[model samples]
Target chain A: MNEEENRPVRWNLDDNGVAELIMCDRERNNLFTDSFIDAFLGALSEIEKERPICLLISGLPDVFSGGADKETLLDLCDGKIVVKDLEISERLVAAPFPIVSAMQGHAVGGGLVIGLCSDVMVLARESRYGAVFMNLGFTPGMGTTELLPMAFGPFIASEMMLGGRMFRGSELAERGVPVNAIVPKADVYRRARRIALQIADKPVDSVYLLKYTLSSEKRKRLIDARRNEDLMHRITFPMPETRRRISEQYNE
Target chain B: MTKEEVIEVIKRNIVENLDDVEADSIDATKSMKEYGANSLDMIEVVSTSMRELNIKIPRSELAELGNIDELADKFMEYINKG
Candidate 1:
C-alpha cells in the first residue's frame, strides 16, 4: 500500500495497500452536495498519490443514499452543482484502481449512478436500487440513463427508469447486472473487504488497466450527459407546470 | 381520445403499477395522486399512459394535476385546444 494521503474522504490505508474510502457526510444522505464534491475530489487527489491497489466505498448502513439532496437539485437547476459533480464523477471513473461499492440499503437517483461508476459492486441481499429522478420530475444528472441500459440491457433498464421501479439485489443480479455477491447487511463490508484484499494481492498494473478499460466509455459519456442534463434541467425548471407540480407535491 | 378514455388509460396504469392498489377502486373520478399513489406510482402512470395512448404528459404535469379530476381536466384542455 502507498503512504496514506490526508484528505476528507476518510481513507484508511491498510498494510496491504488497500484503501477503504468511506464517505463522511451523514447529512444530505451522503449525497455529494457541491461542497462534498469539492472535498471528495481533494480526498481522491490525496488517495491517488499512494496508488492504492483497490478501493472499498461504503456508506451509511440504512440509506446508501436517497439521491441528490433537494438543495443540491435546486443548485443544479441554477447551474451550481452540475459542473462540480461532473468533475468529481470523471475523476472517480478514471481512478486507476478497482472500486467495489458495498451497498447495504436503498440507492436512488444520483446515488445509484455513483454506485454504477464503481467497477464491482457487493450489495446486501435486501438493498434496493432505483433511477428515481422521475419522482422529482427530473432526469438523472449522473449519466444513469446511458449507463443502466448498457449494464443491464435496454428492456429492464427502461423499466427501472421509465417505470421508476426500485429493484432489490436478488432481482438485479438475476438480470446480469454485475454485482459480485449478495450478503446480509451486517456482512456486506466484510465481503467487500475480502474481495478488495484479493484484488490488492494481484499485480497493480494489470488490475488498474482492467478497471480503466471497463470505466472508459462510461466516464466519457457521463461528462457529456452532465452537460446535456444541465441544458435539459434549465429548460424544464421554469415551466409553469413544473413549478405548480412541485408546489402540489410539497403541499401533499 | 376523449377525457374519459385518457382517464381510463391512466387508471389502468395505476392499477398495473401498484401491487397493493386493487383494480376495482381506480374510478376515473378519483384522483390517483390523492389515494396514496406516491411519485413512483405517478411515474409508472405517466410512462404507461404515454406508451399506450401515444400521448405525452410531462412528468411535471403529473404533479400539478393533483387528483384524477385535475389530470383529466388538463388532458381535456390539451385535446380541446388542439
Candidate 2:
C-alpha cells in the first residue's frame, strides 16, 4: 500500500469538541512503526490545534497496540535509533486537555503505558495488558515505570514490569487497579466516549484548567522517571542478551 | 490429567497460538522460544492451555519455566491440587 493509505492512525473532532484518535494498523497489530509514530504525532498536532475539550484514543477490536515495533527494537540494539526517538509518551502526557484511552484490545509494553498516561482509561475484560520489556531483555521505557504505578498500585506495577507477565484486564480489575472502568470488550469504546462527552460538556476553559491542575504532579513525575528510564535503556538496550532476545523472541 | 496429557495440551495450544508451528514438531524438552513463540504468543499458549486444563496458574509463576515439560509440570502441580 502507498504511504498515506498505510498510515495507521487517524483523528477527528466531533461536533461536541471531543476529538477521537483511532489506531487501527491491524496488519501489524498497531505496533509503533516509523510511519505509525509519524502519523500519531501528526494527528496529535492537529488535535491540539483543534483544542478539543477531550481526546479519546482507541484501537482495533482485537489489538490496541503491540508497543515498540520489533524492527525498531532491533534498530535500537544495533545503534540505528535511540529510545528518545519514540516521543509518543511525552507528547501524550503533555496535552493541555484531558485524554481518555479506550483500550479494547491487548496492549503490550509501551502500548499499555500509553493507556496509563491518559486521564481516563477504559480497559477490556478479555484483553491482555503487559509491560513485556523485560521479556525482551530490556528495562521498561516510555515512562512506564512511573505511569504504571500511578494507574495500578506500585506493588502490582512492580509485578508487571519486573516479571514481564501479561495480565488480563479482568485479572487487573480483580486486583483493584485504579482504572476508570474495566468492562466487556464491546463496551470499552462506548464507556470511554461517555466519559469524554461528560468532559466535553464542561466549559472548555474549566476543563482545561482542571486537567492542567490534576496532571501537573503526574507530568513532573514523568519527567523524573523519563530521565532514569533513559539511563536504564542505555545500559540495557545494547546488551548482547538483549539483542539475542529481540532477535529470537520478537514475533510479528 | 497426567503430566504427559498436560504437555500435549500445551503443545496443541502452542501450535494454535504461534504461526508456522506444528503440534507434532513441538518438543516437550525445548522452550517454546525454539518454536518461534514470542512472549505474547507464549502468554496466549499458556492462557489457552490453562483455560482448557481448568487450572489457573499465576503468569508470574510460569515466567521462568525453561521448557514445555516444565510448563506441563507446573500445570500438573496446580491440577493435582484438586
The TM-score leader among the candidates is: 2
lDDT string, candidate 2, A83-139, tens digits: 433488888888999999999988998788789789999998767899989988999
TM, every model: 0.68, 0.79
Q: Which candidate is the best by DockQ?
A: 2
Scored by lDDT, model 2 comes in at: 0.85
Worst lDDT window (10 residues) for model 1 chain B?
B34-43
DockQ of each: 0.06, 0.10
Reference-based TM-score, model 2: 0.79
Error of 1 at B74 (Å): 26
Stretches of model 1 off by over 4 angstroms after superposition: A1-9, A78-81, A174-176, A243-252, B1-82
Compared with the true structure, what per-residue lDDT tens digits does model 2 show for residues B26-46?
889999989865556677788
How far is A3's C-alpha from truth in model 2 (Å)?
A: 7.9
Error of 2 at A54 (Å): 0.4
Residue A93: error of model 2 in Å?
0.6
